[model samples]
Structures are given as structure tokens and as C-alpha cells.
Target: MGRAPCCDKANVKKGPWSPEEDTKLKSYIEQHGTGGNWIALPQKIGIIHIHITHYYSSNPIYLSPPIISFSKQINFSISFFVFGLRMFISESGLKRCGKSCRLRWLNYLRPNIRHGGFSEEEDNIICSLYVSIGSRWSVIAAQLPGRTDNDIKNYWNTRLKKKLLGKHRKELQARNKGNGGILKQENSSSLLLQQNSAQQLHPCWPQIPVLPLSSPYTNQSPSFNDQDSIRKLLIKLGGRFSDDYQPILDGLNLQFPHGSNSLSSTQQIQEEQVHVGSSALGCMNSIGHNQVQFGQSNEYCAELVQGQGSFITTAIGEMVSSNDYSRRLLGGSLEFFYGEEMITDNKIMGACASSSCGQSTNWGETSSSLMYPSLVASNYEGVRQEMPRECAFQELSYPGAQ
Candidate 1:
């Protein structure tokens, strides 16, 4: 059998001290004195000393007499007051470790430490300060009059955290509802764009030889051809790629498989990729590129096809060239695919999508979405993609696979 539990767990005495116990301890200590040692003090004064020592030992105020002086009544053993002086001298910063200093200050030296119930003003201050600083109770108590850090810390752990958490939850719900408005606006804009594109196309749209750009096969074929043209276009563009591409290509050929200590193929690949991806994203987002694509081409069909090809080539080329782009795209795609799969499998798309579709307008709201399912799905996919393909494949195909 296990050893009997240390001390009694249940029925531990709590709340305010009795007047009778107070009177016995106070009168005894006043007459006899503590006589130099805590261990022997109880024995000298009898059971009353033991009871007072135990009571005051547990109460932070008795250990720190300065704080007790703030109270209108003097209701503790005189021995406790004498003990506080010894603790202060031994544990002050002049010679004591941080632990000893903190214990001495908290138990004996700090002043005006209120031990009774917290007032409404004190509660309000704690709640408001906690919002910005979290569990810095020592800091919180410093702001309030007559309140000790220990009391504030206890009240926060037992009471304040729960209230704050509930308030936080309600704030989140309101913020999410606000974000849902922005997402609905974005969805509406996308639908409007689709409608506008439809109006621009021929009425015999079904018969027209048109394929969706979103389709992988249609996207891939043109991307393969445009990859060759992309290198030529980069040459004509006169940017970092135009300047660096030839030198990088020459470096690659010279350093095929591996290079000398002077220049490595791996380093060349990294430099070239960063240059390419930065260039592509910059050029695509520019006003100049948009004007050139739309203005130079006479036929709408030709412009659309060429523009789509350019985008696909830029995206794929950047991915192949830049490790950063590859990792980001791969991770993003994986997360998107996995999340879609999970939602499909679980059949919780409507509810999940509704929650996921919200877009925060403020920094605080956006920060909160870090814990949302949509963000989690996105991050999971992104991190998964960044992992080695072998690892990702293993994750994809596991115990369920034959």
C-alpha cells in the first residue's frame, strides 16, 4: 500500500482568524518574547505560540509586519513582528539571493498589503491592466492602493483569467461577424468579375474553343512553351535577371554537377532564383506590364491567351528558379488541397467555409484568426509542402493504403 498522504488534505482551516486565538498569541508573545529562535519559541510559550506561528506563517501580512501596520487593528503575535525584522536584515538585496529577497519582501517587508476582500475599483483596474499586460500581477498590484502582488496574482489566476477569457470569446465572435462582412464583399467582387467576363465573351460561348485557365492541363501546355519565351523576355526586360541570367547560366555550365571552391552551382542556383522570382512578381504587379499586355495586342483572344501564358510561365519559372517561391507555393497548395480534402471528407464545408471565409480589417482581429481553422489549414499545407517530397508522400499514403 502507498504511504499515507502527508498532512491532512481535506478540512484545512480557511478564512479569518478567531478573536480568542489572536488574544492568546498576542498576550503570550508580549509577555515572554520570541527568545532568539522560531523552533524554540513555540515550546517556550506553549501551544498558543505554535498556533500563532502557524497562522502568521501562512498569512503573508504576519510575515511582513510593515504591511500589517497599515491595518487599523494590531491583531498578531509580537514574535511575528520581531521575526519580520530578522527576515528583512538577512534577505535584503545587500547580501541575499533573488529568491530570498522576493520571499522576504512578499512575506515580511512590503507595505499596505490588503488581506480582506477586493474592492470594485481594484477589480476594474486589474481587469483593464490585465488586457494589455497579461499575468504581470506584481505590476498590476503596484498600480492599486493597499493591494499586494500576491493577492492580485491569486485573484487573477482563480477569478480574472476566466472572466477575461469569456470576454475575449465574445469579442472574437463580434470581430468574426465583422470579418464575415469583408469576405462577403470580396466574394461579391469575384462574382461581379465573372459576370463581366461572361458579358465580354461571344454569346455562343459553349461552341467557342475556350478552356478555363484554372484547368491544369490547359495551363501546363502553354506554360511549357512560354518557359522558353520567358528567358528571351527576361533578356529584353533589362532587369536583375537580364543582367545576372547569362553570368548565372555560364556559372551553371562551368559548375555542372559541382564547382570549385571559388564558385558553387548550389549558390548560383539560389542567387538566380531570388532574382527571377523578385523580378516576376514586381513586373506582373506593375502598371507597365498590364498596359503592354492589353494595349499591344489587337485581338482579345490573342491577348487573353498570351497574358495567361505569360503568367503561367512566370509562376512556374519562378517556382523552379527560387527555393523560397517553390517552398511557399508548395506549402500553400498542399494546405489548400489537404484542407479541401478534409472538409470534403468530413462534410462540414458549409459551416467550416462560413467560418473560414471571414477577412479581418484590423490587426487585432487578424491576429486572432491565427487560431482559426482556415489559417490552420493554410499553415499545415504550407509547412507540409516545405518538407521533403518523400516525407509529404509518406504522410499522404500511410496505414490506410494497400
Candidate 2:
């Protein structure tokens, strides 16, 4: 056999709850806590027992036997609800189901139930958590103290989602404008590598590569406030850029997942050590080895450690900036690399002065590259790259050190 219904469906009132009903439900729950029974709760308020439904339909319920006690089930504060306004049934009880009374108190009449006015902080928390956890509204609601799961779900569907989508569209439009707009490159700094390029072409004027209009923004959807962190990082690593500084950073935007399924991209430039996306720039680590690698091409590579004033040196301490003044103003962030196979031909790349740490520096010919910025550029007198090489301590331009 199946379970019986909690109450008589037709006898119960239905529709918007009246203030009287609200007061009754709230007061009863506060006082007795439903005594753990919804059906019995309303009866406690003054419901006359309708023992015989057929007898009450034709005349007075008193003709039927009175029901002093209800069937099984206990210990839950419950009340039924509906859309109706009427005088309080002082003689009869609230005509609502157990579920209705529970919902009325939890959703509306309860204290601290925020109806609306979601703040920007709440919005970010919602957006970030949603991006990470999807449409888990109950879980999301738990994060917002005064918010309810239903309220959040409805808000996301009706408002917040549209807001994010509109912003996403604006970003797309702006990105399109960039394809043929503000980013036209106008200068290039060919760092003094070995010797400056001697082309009659203006070394100061740059040849910025024109990109197509269809390229998408690198980050999926990042919040606007993340800009402060990004700005600080960019300034810290500002000198790290060669000529492509504008373009690379231009592509970087802090992103949140614009769509429920879109992936969130995370980048960190503020760490004690710098890291960014590029085939040419990378940091490597092993048991006791830490190497920062940079190059013009995949086939071309070289190793560098911090040196005095905007410069990097070979694994065995050699001035990367082949000449004098170029050594100070721009350091050795720029380098000329050759192939490992040519280590003995003496055709290119300076030979190691005195091999340190029993390791040899190999230089491969690459077309374009830039390395780490001077750590303590303020005092360029010299730098010490934290690596595992004894010769790493030699002073720049020291006898045969270069």
C-alpha cells in the first residue's frame, strides 16, 4: 500500500499568503517550532477536527466524530501555504500543507532574508565560484550569508548572466578595433648584441607586425578589478620586454569564465621570480639546478645569470653585452647565440674562460631574443645569478671574465 496524503487538498486555502497567515506561521514556528509536525501544527492553532468529510459537506462538521489526534509522522516545523487574504480563522487552523508553511518561513517571513540589492563583491564571489563550480546554486548560496539558493539561481538566470555576456560582447568589439587600431608599432630597440645592427634603416623606427581582425582575446573572461595586480607586475617586469613588449602585454587580460563552460585562465607575474607564456622565455628546475632559458628560435638557446646593471652572463661569468657603454644602459638581456655543435670550431661564441661547476655554456644561433631584467638595476655595479656555478661570482668585464 502507498502512504496517505497529509491533508484534504480541497479544504486547504491556496494562493498568496495573507499577513494574518504569515504572522500565525512565523509566531507558531518561533514559539513551538512546529512541535516537529506540519499537519498537527495548524490544528494546534485552532483547527476543528473534520472527522467525517461527507457529513461536513452537507452540514456542520460537528455532526461527525472529532479528530483529536493526527496520523503518524513527527518533529518537523511544517505549514502549507497559498495565495489568499482573509480574516484569521481564530476558530479554525491555517489551511496550508506542511511544505507550504516551511517554505513561507524559510523564503519570505524569515528574518534576514535579503530580497535583492546584490553588491559588486557578492557578484564577483558568485561569478568566480560559478566559473569554478558551475550551476551549483545551493553551494554558491552558502557563500553569501543573507542570500538564498533560489534567489541566487533566479538572479543568475535573469540578471547576472546577461550582464557578463554584455561585457563579453563589448570586449570582443574592443579587441576587433585593436586589430587595425591603437597598436601600430612605431619603435624598436635593437639591444647592443656583440655590436649594433648597422642597416641604413632607422633603428629607432619599428616594424610592428599587423595582425588579422579575427584574433580572439587571450583571456576567456576576467573581472575588471584584477587590473591593479596586473599593472604592478607589468611595471616590475617592464624592462624585461624587448620590442614586442606592447603586443605581448596587450594580449594579456585577466579573465574569468565568460560562459558557464568557458575555461578560466590564470597568470602570475607578481611572484618573487617572473613567469609568463612564451616559447623563448622559461624557467627550469631540477634536484639542485635552476636555469632561466631564453632564445630567438627553438633551435637557438643560451643560459644567463644576473649581472651588474641590466645584464646577464654566461654560465661561467662572461659579459653578455660584448662592448663597454652597452654594458650599462641596456645590460646583456640581449645575446648572440650559436649552435652547440660549433663549441670547438671557434668560428662563433666566446670560449669559456675557466669552466666552472664542471659545466660548459653552449650558445646556439637564434634570430631574436631578450632575457631577465637586472634584479637590482639600481646598483648595476654587478649581479649574482642564483645558480649552481662556482664561476657565477666573477665580476663583469673582469680579466677574461668577458
Candidate 3:
């Protein structure tokens, strides 16, 4: 009940086609044409038939069919132009399949078939079409004249994909290098700031005080009336500014200049006009016009006695007198930090005492100038032995809280 064979297996030789066989197949199709039947064409073209062995019954089976009458020549010509030419040659003579003969003619032997290297524009078109439609190489090939789907597919795999990968890898490497350089520069600046701060502290002070030097958040002109939040932040930072360190404002209650009187009371810091510098001591005006308190406190002499052991009088003197140093702290916004090793020495207390002596125009400026020298000076000291264990937040808070 199995279907009959298409051709005699023994007579049909299957493998590479010879030049003579190619010529014969090509010549026959050119002269007489396929006659519309591939199965019969092999016999008509002088391919010998032989018996094929049947496996189930161990018997030989032979298959042959009669050739049909030829169609009208006009119909054949129209079909030939539309479908292109065809060939039917079994492996017995030509050693090539009928399909193989058709492909050889259409791809190579057909009229106006150009074969060679693809141009740059064609390559671009192919790549764009492939990307848009995906790997439908035949569709891409149609857009690119004189190119085959197989050729386009092979070129993309062997050439274009590698080219694109190389470019992408180079871009990625360059991006990484830029990022690495930025990180290196930031680290270097931070280290340099710490070193300079360490060098500024006078040697006489016993324990150092640490401060948050700079961060992105500190660079901005923050909303000023948030004194409640500022106070809370300070309280959270171990009550450094809450009681023990609050400035004793004596006789000086400096009023703000004409238009700036609402500073810190009702008006917020002007964000656009504010510019942050290294120490933040110069930009106090941006904090909004508010009352700045200064005092001459002879009563704090008992309080000064506690820091007398570690206080450097000369260091406090120079620090209080330096308008430049005071200006630097006021130049930027207040930034708080935690868990840095700062030496809490008496030089800071001495500076605070010295600051109380001045009836200053800007109390915010004077207080910061007094506080940060100790903060900066404390950073370089040995934290393991000298730093106290009592406070939860051991580092400096913003000077504005003072």
C-alpha cells in the first residue's frame, strides 16, 4: 500500500554534478524546456531507469508513467516568463536534483543577475531593513538590488555583527574610563580637604573636634525658617548646641540691614542668589535678614574654667581676629555629619570665649568662625584614645544652630 517511487533509485546517481552533466541539463532545458513534468523529464532526457529493491517483501519494484500531451505554446511561454525557466535532471545522468538545476539557472544563469561585492549603500540598506523587519533576509534582499537572501545573511553574520560589536565595546570602555576619572578626582579632593583641615589646628589643644566638611546637600541654600528642624537635628546630634554650647549673647543684638530684616524669621534663603564656597563662612547674608546676637560676657569666666586646661589662648586670639576665616564659614550652608573622629580640645572653648568678647555685627559669622577651627582641628587627632564615648552623634553640626 506504500506510494510508488518517483524514479528508479539504482539508475539515479546522487552526488556532485559534473561539468558535462551541468551542460547537458542546461542545454536540454534551453532547447526543449521542462515540458511541465519534472518526473517524466528525467526519462525523456535519456536517463536510464532500473528496478528499486523493496524492503518489506524482499522483492524489486519498478515505477514508470506515460508522458502527458504538451500544453499550448502561448501558455507555456507566458508561464515561462512569469515563473522563469525550469529543469528536470535526476542524479542518474546529471547527478543533480531538478530543484538544484532551477536554482543554478535563476541565481547564476538568469538574465541581468549581477554578482560581486556589495556596495556601502546596499550594505546600509540591508542592515536597516534587517533591523526593522528582523531576519527576513529575502525581504531585505528585495530592497537591495542584485543581492541574494543567502548572501545578505552570510555578510551580516560574518561582517556587520562583528563590526557593530567592536564599536559598542569601544564606547563602553570610554564611558567607564570617564566614570573612573570622575571618581578618582572626587576622592582626591576629599582627601586634600581633610589634610588641609588637619594642618590648620593649633598643636596646644588637647582633644580635637570633628565636623562635617562638605557634601552636595551642604552646597545648597536651604530654606532658613526651618529652625525647628535645625534644632531637632542638633538635638539628635547629641545636644552639642542645645545647652552646653549655646552662645551667651550679652549686650549685642544686631539688627538686620534695611531690606533684609526678615531673615530667618519670615523669609527663606534666596536660592538663586546663594553661592557656596569652601568653608561656608562668607555667605551669611543669604540666610535671610534676621537678628544676629553678640555679647560681652564676663559672667562665663566660670564656664571658661572647664576648658582652661586644654585651651590655647594665642590660637583662640588669632582665630577670633581672622575676618577671613570667619568669612569662609559663612560662605556656605550648614551641613551636619556623624561618626567622624574629631578631637574635642579646649582651644575650641577658648575660641568660643574669645568670640563672646566681641559685640559683633554678625553673630552667625562669629560663632561659626569660633566653632569650625576646633571642628577642623579635631579631625587629625587620635580618635581611639582621646575621643569621648559619651555622645551618640560625635561629629559637628551646622554652625547656624549655634
Candidate 4:
């Protein structure tokens, strides 16, 4: 454009530095002690005048002595200190954004930074706390000295999450095994109790044959006839009289004869009659004769009546007490059932709690006590093939009875 930007003349300054020019510049800088202004010094030193570009620019048409000297001995300490101060202030106030501060600190000023793997104790604490606390890596990191939140978060994602998941799977398996053992113990205890209860009752008691009213006793003596007449009269007056008195007539086995609807409403009278018959029969037998003293005004008969009543009352009381004890055990077991639910709910709530700390969701309002037995029973049934028969008996017999 302007004479092809002028081909370099032998005496003309070149497009690039020649060896001779470079030598000349070096010698001049060495002699001048490397501190003079480039644009002014060239003219003063009788060299061709050259202009130096500003420090902020990329392309330079010429060089200046002052600019070159300043660049060589650049003192960055002040600049770095100012930058670090600003970065810290901005991070503290959360004003300049973490990304900007981190970039400035890390890229330009961070010294002796460790960029390696975490230690074993760090791994263990992280894993355990993570199981209980889930995410909240920042808080976890704070507990682990010399660790950063970002480092922990990354490690958890990449390595710890998988390891912990494996551990949790094993824990679940162990819990299932423990549950199975408990179920087996419950089953064995219930079976043994059932067998013992069955053995305690007289074998012949369950098969008593009903008899007709007109049948006479084997002994046809007048005393026997009078006793039979009294028994018949007592039965006619709504009493429960067992002709066969080989076994203790516990009220539990005193089911009225099959289809004896006439006797259902008169159970109390039947019970009284049975009591009377038992007392009368006891007096006739050798044991009975000795049990009562002659001319003693049947005080033993009265005592026997009182004892029989007490026995009936005691048996009924025992049954009721046993039922209550079973219910309490069941309630305590139900509490354990709810306790498991609470553990599961707590884990869920912990995750939610960590994630929603700043939210107004009222997580504390939830309660484990509200967990009903019905819910746990359903879950229990699914896992167990057959419930402890006694427990099931208790549950079914006392549905809403408790």
C-alpha cells in the first residue's frame, strides 16, 4: 500500500530484530543499567527513535526503556495481597459469589494445596455419619479436619456411596435373620405352652356321656334314692348337676349339653346345682366323708362351697390375668413393631430434615406413637408364615377386647 510497506534498507530498522540489532540493544541495555525510558533514551543515545506500546496492549511497534525495566522487575506481592483481601471479604459477606472467590484463590494464590486421596479414619467417619445423617456433606466435612466440603461430596459420590450401599445390604440381611430367630423362639414357646395346657386337663373329662333323668343309681338304697331325688329336684330348679364326678368340674369344661337351649339362660342356676351335686357327692365318697366331720353342721360343705366358688372365681381370674399378661407382652411387642417403623421413619425424616432445614414443613409434628397395631400386624403376617398360635389366639379372641 505505501511502497509495499518499504523493503528493509541496510540502514533501515527491520520488521524483526537482526542479530546485530539484538547485540546492539543488549550492549546498550547492559551499559545503561537497564532502567532508562525507551522512547526518550533512544533519542538521547543517538539511536533511531522508537516508540513503545502501552503495557496493556498486545501488539508493539517499538520498545520503551521504562516499560521494559518495569516489566522485568514487576512486584506482584502488592497485587496478590490486595486480591486475597478482596476475595476473603467477598467470601465472608457472600457478596462476590463463591465461584469467583474460589477461582481467584485457587488459581492465583492457593499455596501448598493437597490434591490427593483422603485417609482411612476420614473414610470411616464419613461412612458411618453418612449412614445416620445422609447428605449434609458440608457439615460432615467440618467434622473431618483438613477436608473440604467439595472433596467429601465428590468422594461420597464416587466411592463412599457404593461402599455404604453394600454395607446397608448386609445389615438388612442380618436384621432379617434376627427377625427369623425371634419368630422361631416365639413359635416354640407357644407350642410348649399349648401342649402343657392340653396335658393339664383330665383325659376323660372331655368325653363325658350325657345321661337320662329317669336312670337310677347302681346303689338303690334309701339314702341313694333320697340323694337322687334331691339331685333331680335341684336339676328341675335350674341347676347344673354332673352325674359323673370323676374329674374336677372346672367351669371351663362345663359346656351345657349339646342343643340344651333350655339351660343356656339358666347357667348361674346350673352352676349352683353343679356346686351342690359336687358337695353332696363329696360327702358320700370316702374322701368326701373324711373331708366333712360328723355333726359338724356341714361347715366343711360350706367351706367346700366357698372353695368351689373361689376355685371358679380363681380359674376365671387366672384366665383374665393370663389374658392381660399376654396383652401387655403383645403391647410391648407392638411397641417394638412401632419402634421399627419409627426407625424407618426416622431415616426418612433425617434425610428430609437435612434437605429441608430452612423450610417450614413441621416435620417435628409427626409421632411414632400413632402407629397402630393393625398396620404392624399386617406387615408381620406377610413375613411370618404362621403367627405364634397363642399370639394369634390372643389377637383374634380379643379383637377390640383389649
Using TM-score, give the best candidate's number. Answer: 2
**Regions of model 4 farther than 4 Å from truth:** 1-109, 127-134, 174-180, 183-402
Cα lDDT tens digits, model 1, 216-269, are: 111121121233354455454445434433322222222111111111233232
| Residue 384, candidate 1: alpha-carbon lDDT | 36
Better candidate by lDDT, 3 or 4: 3
Our tally of clashes for model 3 stands at: 28
- True-structure lDDT of candidate 1: 0.30
Error of 1 at 156 (Å): 0.4
Query: Where's the lowest-lDDT run of ten residues in candidate 2?
Result: 281-290
Clash number for every model?
Answer: 5, 26, 28, 5
**lDDT (tens digit, per residue) of candidate 3 on 258-310:** 33322222012111011111122211212211112111121122112223332
Question: How well does each candidate superpose onto the true structure, as a TM-score?
Answer: 0.25, 0.35, 0.30, 0.23
Model 1 stretches with alpha carbons more than 4 Å out: 1-20, 24-120, 127-139, 183-402
TM-score of 3: 0.30
Per-residue lDDT of model 2, residues 222-318, tens digit only:
2324444544443433343223232222323323224411111111110111111112111101100111111111000113222211121232122
**Alpha carbon lDDT at 88, candidate 1:** 20
Cα deviation of 245 in candidate 4 (Å)? 76
Residue-level error in angstroms, candidate 3, position 80? 36
Model 4 Cα displacement at 207 (Å)? 56
